[model samples]
Target: MSARISNNLRSAKAVAAALSDSEDERLSENSNDGSVFLVSNDEDSEIEKVKGEDVITEYEDDDEFDLETEPASKQRRLNKGADRQSCRGSRSSGNPNFSTNTKNDDMDVETPVEAFRVLFDDAILDKIIIHTNEEIERVMCLLISKEHQCQSIHKKIDKEELCAYLGLCFYSAYFKENESCVKDMWDDVFGRGIYRATLSGKRFEFLNRVLRFDDKNTRSERRATDKLAPIREIWDIFIQNCTNNFEPANNCTIDEQHKPEIIMSYNCYKGATDTFGEKSHEFSTARRTARWPLRFFYNMLDQSAVNARVAYNLNADNPRLSRKKFLKKLAFGLVEPHLRRRLGIATIRASIKKIIRKLLEIDEHVPAVVSVIKENTRSKCHLCDSNAVGRTRMKCPNCLRRMCDDHRTAICVECSAAN
Candidate 1:
């Protein structure tokens, strides 16, 4: 506010601008609020007062003083084609300062929506649609016959609409997989309010019947053991076909860019990605819960990822697919011919008596050993110290006392209750 104070500040700045080039190289940079600062070389008294430290004014100054800061009265001549010799830079005009460019050419410029659209190539989508409709019909018959209540429920899903529904489910769930339920996914796909309209179909029906398989005809001893036989076949076809089509990177290493399945470190460096910050929780959350009823979700989550990869990989495989024009006859193209070996079951279990006898023999008529707790070795009983009997075989944990097998009880109430 005052001329004298302002003069002092300017004098300090001039001195700092002078001394900045000579400080310890490894020391932290002089910075304030992220802006680079400099050291002051004001008069010894002023420097000490301003910085609250001893001022070592005897050290030599550096050439960077004038190289960086110039006095207002004495203007610096710009780097015009030099007339005199200098060591700081090449004086020739041909040696123009070449600043580095910040933009990356490798980054994908496609929008998420556009990238997503590329995944559902028309033919693969058609195959998916047909496969889906067939599943719906087959499931519908089972529901109607076994569940008489299904007589009241009726719906027909065509290929086009079913495909769209599946796409929407993926689009919504991919973004919010960790935090939201399937219903939340639907709400996101449709819109966010009581007044919002959505696709006209049965939500309950879709959830219950989507990709479910039920078969009761087989009575073989060993069949591929589970429900969802038909759906699993479809899933296998999709994974196999997509895997066959993919081309891995020429020089890309898995542990570098792609995360490893075998976890060696929890705290380790992860590579950069565009969505790294926003979707940051995915990796940590994935690591935290690696088991449980997440089997359904584990597959779905992978599908969401592979959907993106399918887009990117196909892009890299041939730029033509990514750019414009069509891929040659895209199709689900599932060939459903599979061979299986059937094992026979014995039909000679004529009486329940023989079955019971076989089960008892298998068990050897002994109840299983539920648990065993070992004890420390000891030479004598804690109670009687009897050498006449076998050496002490166990110890009392609480009191650190030894006991022979003759004196050993299954559990000592006193010792068991103690801490």
Candidate 2:
């Protein structure tokens, strides 16, 4: 009985398959002919039979189509579906495309020196909150520009050349800008992330090089004036603002793990139990002569100590020397070998002597003004050293120096004479 039923069903399936093909051809012919389409009962009966056979056929295939035994085409389709779904989710969630490279085509080629000037013009520069941004960009531009000119003569710019350009550029412009704002942004520019290419592994190693420019301030300037504290304070503010406030949507996540301290202690004092001391080399002398500002010296030493300790912990085989020895070593390392390699120590020393002489002259000239101004300006004008100072009066139309009500022609007597 079952054999008879199976034979009958197979014959019915064959008849249904033939009718399905006939119907498909008729539908296509009618579609092209644009005639009145008709679904007769005979065609409907044939369609129902075909659909029943298709269901049976799908069941048979599903039984044979074990996922483990599925063909590569099926697997590929499955994977493609999953990938599409994941991409949809990523797009919906605002996933950052971190893989996009930051370097532009112009960055690799001969970058125009004016590229920096364009980047730092008032429109872009005014948006920067960090104080060091403008100065750093300026110096970077100057160094790169100067090096570009030098390299044009030779036809190349290498990594060392780039670094030396940075060093010279930064050092040259260090004292020319407003010191207060410069000091405030010290950490963000020099202490953290990758500014130019300084390594933070050495504690305040980079910052110490930076603060060298400001070390010449007279004793009075060293005191906390109304303006701002020394360079270290500037760095602290930068670090605080950057870590706590700035919203970095793209870069690496910086957290407490990275900033282990408010400021790293460069030199440690073994003898003292004080919170700030850890017996560093600069401690004794700095305390004795009071040559450097105590706060600035402490900050420098602390940063150095922190870096030295980190280096020691990392087992970095960097040359370890006493405080005085390290300065000499760093100074020696600072001299550019490509340009001055042939120069002898005597020539270098002579250059150093000239720099020292110039520095001393500045020191003498600055103090003379300070003393004279102190005597006369008890509350007097900085230019004329006269008590001719007042508020709510027009400035000297010529000199623009503020003058007393009596002097509001405010023809600064000094400017009047100059004309």
Candidate 3:
């Protein structure tokens, strides 16, 4: 989602800082779980100033803002060593020395469902199956009622029936516009008993409430200005998970990838508008608004499928494999190399923790590395190769002094020009 969002917007840097900041929050959340950062063997890891963002936010409106896995065995040991070396190198020399791999590593590719199934127990999965069944049946009933001009009788939707129904919907998507809607799918063709259970929207709502793992009192406290002392516990967990995933970013290169804002905002704006309202910022608002809803939850589950594959690939027998190169190759191949989402940083972090912890709970046998790195190192400037800032550093819109300072409080050329 983040990758897609970046494609829509003209400026990707706009959210880089947002991501960086939330990275800390997410990392901190995992401190106790041994899932994010490997507890530093060294007591002092030097904190560098924030740097590398191309441009600061142009949003004068203050509303812009924001927001892991593990692997295993022989490969995991290498990552741990690499992580320790990277950290110590950063502290002593103020530079990043991170993952360096050859080209022969094995690749683990997942078929979506295989990876996601680890996160849910039979009970949770059953609940999902049940809810999905209800959802499909409800839509079918509505369609039937409208067509027949009478109150359609509700029916019980089972897993096999839903699967048959979905198989058609999946194929139907290629139709002129879309053939996935429940109404469009109800026929004698897909399967005879697939949708025997169809209920009206009202009836479904009455039978089962919205599925949520968080407390009813749970809500974001970030909007508060007065150094809000209390925030939800879930948010903490989410941040730690993110830090774990984001930890490997020892240095960020200033590659001239297409205009992130233009690419992402234009393409993803419609999605954000569709998901939230047009009024929300494409990444920030849309992501926060969606949070751990079933759709996002599904996406998180889907992401695990990819990560598990990556972990497997890393652990593959090829000792000569290059992890970074392998990831880049995989990026172009069948699976996504990163957990890219275009939502607010915080919300996305929460979604990750949700997926990871659930998996950890259900599949305790799964290694923590599948969802997060052993630890993260500070990012160094691609040019200077110096230890860079901790979170996000600003680039001058005026002068070229882009490597050393915090511009969050001070005004930039936009303000200077006005003066």
Candidate 4:
């Protein structure tokens, strides 16, 4: 480059450095309204330029003159800690200047990972530097808002939005130890969304008794293997269905309306863990106590807890866990030891029916039930109960008899299609 042009760029760079400080002052000085902060050797000219109708447009074309994309010169003293002192100059540090120590701390503690933590923090700082104290507090609260634990806490945002934010945190911190901690605390306090997030995180340790590749050790290994299959199968269904509407980029924003059963399952899993401690025995006891399917006791406990959580909105309840203790006992059966031997199929079915009824309130299993009900109510011919509904002849495919719509294989479309 020519020396004159280079010199001009150097001079511009120097002015830019000075302008950073001026920028903050300008932002503060015009706090109620916004004004552009311009840097130029001719102050009057720059001010006049800013006032012109096409000022931003004129400057837009000359972005190379802007400081951001420009190449740094040897004369520039940009380094750590430069922005700390200046009122308006650019902060020398990059976004996420959080120290290595902070990264390690976040990792160890399972703090949530946000997509734009650095950007968000920077924006908050910028707002603070410019806004009134009240606005600063309001913006900070928005940035750090968490899911409501109780009604007395004065809600400012919807629960689903809160869940999405929490989900973002969980999703961002995937595979981190702190993620597990966050999941645990979230489950303990909030419940429903945590199970879905945990299961999605695929950090099996966060899921109580739902054994994964890592949990296979000693007797615990065999037990976890035995307990894990059904839960895993259920999760496979849950994930496939729940994720149908969510692309990876937008996974955090699950609507409360979609995949109700999956949501129920997530809540149930969370509730079970909260009721039962993280250890295997507590899970085992809770499973038996809840009177869930004993063969897959641990799996049922995990799934059930999630269901209960989502269904009840336990996190937002006035008195959290009030129903938890009773539900656990009722589901598991705190009947005297002698009563266990005398318990019949009817009793077991009744317990299951009760759980199912409660689950319906949350509508978590509505999708699954609706799918089943639709399959059950399809049109079919009547001559024999073995014909496909749409067939022109209306003859039974299996029985080969003439049939009408009324009795043509009451088995319905799903069964016929399966055949």
- For each candidate in turn, the TM-score is 0.31, 0.20, 0.25, 0.17
**Alpha-carbon error at 318 in model 3, in Å?**
11
Reference-based TM-score, model 1: 0.31
Where does the lowest 10-residue lDDT sum fall in candidate 3? 278-287
When sorted by TM-score, best at the front, the candidate numbers are: 1, 3, 2, 4
lDDT of 2: 0.32
Q: Candidate 4 — worst ten consecutive residues by lDDT sum?
A: 109-118
Candidate 2 per-residue C-alpha lDDT over 1-419 given as tens digits, one digit per residue, 9 for 90 to 100: 33443343344345444445465433221344342212233422221122222224322322221223458657756665565466545533655631122123232212112222222223322222233233344445677878743222222223333333333323322222212232332344443112112212221222233222222344247555623343444444434422332223342222222222211211111111222243333322121223244345434333333223322222224334444343323222332432232122243333333333342242312211111111223233334444544333334444555454454332333223223
Candidate 1 ranges with C-alpha deviation above 4 Å = 1-153, 174-196, 213-232, 250-419
Ranking by lDDT: 1, 3, 2, 4
Best by TM-score: 1
Candidate 4's residue-wise lDDT over 1-419, tens digit each? Answer: 23343454444444444444565432222333333434455433322223332213322323333333445422233421232234112212422221112212222211111211211233332322232233334434654676423231222322222223323332322222222343453453454332332222223221222212211224255555575532343334444432332122211113333342243123222322333333322223221222232234334333333333323332232234333342333232211221222222243333333333343332322211112122223344454446454533455555555455555335443333222
Report how far residue 172 has shifted in candidate 2, in Å: 21
> Residue 257 error for model 4, in Å?
24
- Please identify model 2 stretches exceeding 4 Å from their true place: 1-233, 237-278, 281-306, 309-313, 316-328, 335-419
Write the number of the candidate with greater lDDT, choosing between 1 and 2: 1
Error of 2 at 385 (Å): 60
The alpha-carbon deviation from the true structure for residue 9 of candidate 3, after best TM-score superposition, in angstroms, is 18
Per-residue lDDT of candidate 3, residues 1-419 (tens digit)? 33333232323344543445465433231333332212223434322223322222332111121111223344545664565555545534633333322232222224322222223224444554655445545556676778854232234544433322222222222121121334333433552121212222233232223334333332244325422212223233433443343324333222223343343223222221222221111111111123335334433332333333334444445333333333223322221111122111343333343333342343323222211111233333233435544432434333423333333235333223223
Candidate 2, residue 400: Cα displacement in angstroms equals 65
